[model samples]
Target chain A: MKVMMSLTVNGKLETIAVRPGATLLEVLREDLRLTGTKRGCDHGDCGACTVLVDGEPRLSCITLALQVRGRRVDTIEGLAREGYPHRLQEAFDREGAAQCGFCTPGVLLSAAALLAGNPHPTREEVRDGLAGNLCRCTGFQKIVDAVEAAARGEGDR
Target chain B: MDFLIEQPDTVEEAVRILAERPGAARAVWGGSDLVVEVRDGLSRPEVVVDLTRIRELVEVRETGDGGLSLGAGVPLEHLARRPELAERFGALAEALRAVGSVPLRFGSTLGGNLATASPAADSAPPLLVLEAEVEIAGPGGRRRPALADFFQGPRRTVLGPGEIITRILLPPPPPGARGTYLKFARRRALDLALVSVAALGWPDAEAASGVRFRLAAGAVAPTPLRLPAAEEILAAGRLDEETRTAVRRAVEAAVRPIDDVRAAATYRREMAGTLALRAVDRVLRTLEGGVA
Candidate 1:
């Protein structure tokens, strides 16, 4: 089944044909080639496929492609500015948050959503915001620190 | 695949299409659970009825009768944010808040939770405790059924082939009554329950007359089970140590759990008793006039 969907991805408008069964993760990665939105569990269990749907972190792997019609989607790739790293990306780098980097993109997106919603989130809020995303590396302390750094506006420095 | 139909206008239209094409269509709201089920091949339907466009099903209104009539499409996040729901039906609000992570909550619907019919569904136990009833629409007409009678088994509901749940009616909590919902899981969020319990209490000994102690246990039976025996025990008197112990025993005895990936049968049975006791104690301490 094919349906016409108009979506704004990473600030760009796109009209694409999507199947009812096609997931947002598939469209983002396979159709748009935005591989930054990694496919983790395909189910909602893992946050490895997290992305920003209208500035809110969502599990893209389980989200239907057609469901995002007329909605805005932001992937990790969208965070980059002019070949440079976004603040979140830089923080993840300096704090060594991306140990394996397999979970980095999703965690970064979730953190980005949090920072966008709350400029200065407490440590507990950060923990809660990223609760869906799992990281097998960095023991999660560094990821928390990275988000904290981003929130403090220290990522640029 | 023939085609996909995205009808988001009204429940009447959704139900019309569902009845016209039964096996080919499935309703989509929030898409938190349905999308995953479709992707995993657990469900396959040709036409996807997107219910997010239905404005009527998204409302949460206070009935003139002092009850709450929640649209089936109301998001879990919205339910969690309602002050009245938090104050009057604290257990249901808490259960909604405990579902999945924040993002998932934003996309999960109360109707979706009920339709999924998972025995471990977080919202079921609380809704059961609230004595909630569901209004379902089908080709024939609309029918209302108690939440207890809605679930047939795991992932199965009493809904007809083309029936769509329209609203959930929750009776107002009695004055001086407070409720609490507790779930035990291995992780902090996005985890299924090992065992969940919802307990409501009324503080006034006299006003508490005929006060129902609806106990809904999740993940401890084929479907979410209401502990009539436990409710009977609590109705006898104040929830003291003795009454609490008796209620716990009744809950443990009523549940017939099985060993699964999430937990062992024995653990679920034990936690049924433990969670019932803890929830009763918490409600009594917090709301029942500081009673033990």
Candidate 2:
């Protein structure tokens, strides 16, 4: 079935027709061409498809496209301001948070959500907050460091 | 079968839709497990009754009997954040804390967890220990069943075709009661349990009595099992070396585990014994006015 839904993506309002079975990841990557939200494990195990649904990190791959109606959706591409990197994105670049970059978008989104809620999270809190995101390449030490740096408002370009 | 997605604002409307749709529709709350199952092709429902829109099912009310009524749509994250739940229903709160990750906890509903009926589901053992009952609504009427009787087998429940779980009633523990939930998983976050145990009971200060315990083991059997024999042994006296050994033996006997990818049946049996002993020992220490 087709469902017409209004989604505010990256601060822009968009009205799109989505299939009931289509996932948010598919809509972001295919329909909207916001390919920054990578699709890893569509089953929600991997955090590669993470996006901010109402400023909270959510697994877009498992979330139905129709469920995001009247909600603000933010992908990794949406985090930047007019080609400028977000604080989290800048920290990732400076601290080498992304090794392979496959998990970068998801990690950035999760970290962004964490920092938005808690700007000064402890190391343990940052680790626990991003526990859902899995990074096989960087071993998560650098990611943890990046999140810590971002939370402290340090190491930003 | 027609694809019908009903967003009912009230319970009556939901029940009416269920009555009209019969077996074709299934109530979806949280959709953490159901959505995954549906996406994986395990369940193909003609109608998806989205219960998230129902505001009435999102409340956490305290009954006059000092018990808690968790609406069917209350997310696990919300349950974990309740200070009163942590202070009063320690086992339940601890179990809620250990379910999946923060994102899954935010999206997963307690009713959905119970309805999924996974033996390893974190909420079930604690609810079993709490002697929780579920209020289920169907076309005919509403019925309440003890949480234990709600499960028929793995991924199965006694809920009729058109029925939906509306609320979970968890009575407060008796005065002087202490409860703890111990989960042994492969990792700290987002891992399924190899074996888990929830112990809830009160201390018997008089005579040779120690803490009377109720032990519920998860992920080792077809359904989470209450180790009554182990509880009996604990109720006999303090869980000293001798009693701990007896309780461990009873727990080992109570569980019927299977060799899965998570762990071997023998390993699960051993872990169940260890967890039961540890949980009982920890609660006993608390009862003795020592911090655990």
Candidate 3:
């Protein structure tokens, strides 16, 4: 049986009918057409499906769609407001943090959550914050640099 | 992947659904473990009773006896950031941080960790040393059991039919005691521990041994178990180089590891003692705020 669940995604309220066992990643990518949330490893080991549920970075791949009912979910698409991109996203661009861009969305969201709580994180903190996100393209050096740059407000300029 | 999901607002209601369904139902909260199991065909439940909606299972309260009552549904990340738990129960705080990742920890619960009953559970070794108790709610009522006796084997626990772990009761740390948890994994983050050891100790000048130690290890046995042989050695006298070596050897001898995909039984046995020694050394460190 499919359950009708209403959730706030990227500040937009949406009600959709989903299977009882459908994953949030499935609903985000398949049902709502919100493909910004990647589906790397459906088993939750790969954090490519990371999203912010109530402002916490959670793996959408393993999260049940029904679990997020009535909760605020922020995806990578929400990182940019209108034409302006989030500082972390811009910093990634400036630092060449992304190559294939497969893991960029999840990494950006995880970085967003980390910076939201810690505006000025240390290099080690940035590494630890982004540890869950894996990027086979760039050996994480550029990604770490990008996160630190964003934390330093380098992207503002 | 095909199952009825029931969200109960209270523990009583949750237990009723579980009792009614019996073997057909399973309790789930922060499905980090259960979701993977279901997807991998390791677990199949016709109905999943989601307990995240239960208010009583998501709090951390002082037990009014200098102890702490940790609600089963409280996320591991939430507990890791708790100042009281961090200050009083250093080993537990360290162990919680050693779990999956920041986000994974946010979605994994203490109850879910214990319910899975994995021998490699990071939370078990520390809780065992702290003498934590698990409070189980069933159709009849609630019963608290020692955390030591909670596990029967890998993916097994003492929880009976229709029973759900409601909370974990943590006794207050002994006066002047310090503790530490050492987890040996291939990598730091997102890797299950190959061998883990937790130790809690305090100086006791009047006692026969002049010190008291509680030592336990994980991922080296069927269940997380105390290294009584090592604990007895430490309790015998002062912790000199000889005593440390004896403790290490005792731990190596006490553990009954198995050959698994993660590590060989021999490697696990050896590392378990090494980590145990490191944990003891860390717990006995004299520097203020040095112990984790």
On DockQ, the candidate that comes out on top is 3
lDDT of 1 by residue, A38-72 (tens): 88777787789888888878788767788788999
Worst 10 contiguous positions by lDDT, candidate 3 chain B: B283-292
Q: Candidate 2 residues A74-136, lDDT tens each?
A: 988888887888888888899888988988998888888878878898888888778888888
Query: Which residue runs of candidate 1 sit more than 4 Å off their true CA positions?
Result: A81-84, B1-3, B207-212, B238-240
Top candidate (TM-score): 3
lDDT of 1: 0.84
lDDT at position B90, candidate 2? 89
Rank all candidate structures by their TM-score, best first, as comma-separated numbers: 3, 2, 1
* TM-score of every candidate: 0.92, 0.94, 0.97
Cα distance off (Å), candidate 3, residue B216: 0.6
What docking class should model 3 receive?
A: medium
Give a tens-digit lDDT track for model 2, residues B1-292.
Answer: 1245677888878888877877667777646676677877878877777787788789999997889999988878789889989888989999988887766776788889988898999998889989999999887789999998999889899987678889999987876777899999999888999999998877555425645678899998998888888877777765468877898899999999999887999999999999988887677666545522
DockQ of 2: 0.43
Error of 2 at A78 (Å): 2.3
Using lDDT, rank the candidates from best to worst: 3, 1, 2
The collision pairs in model 2 are none
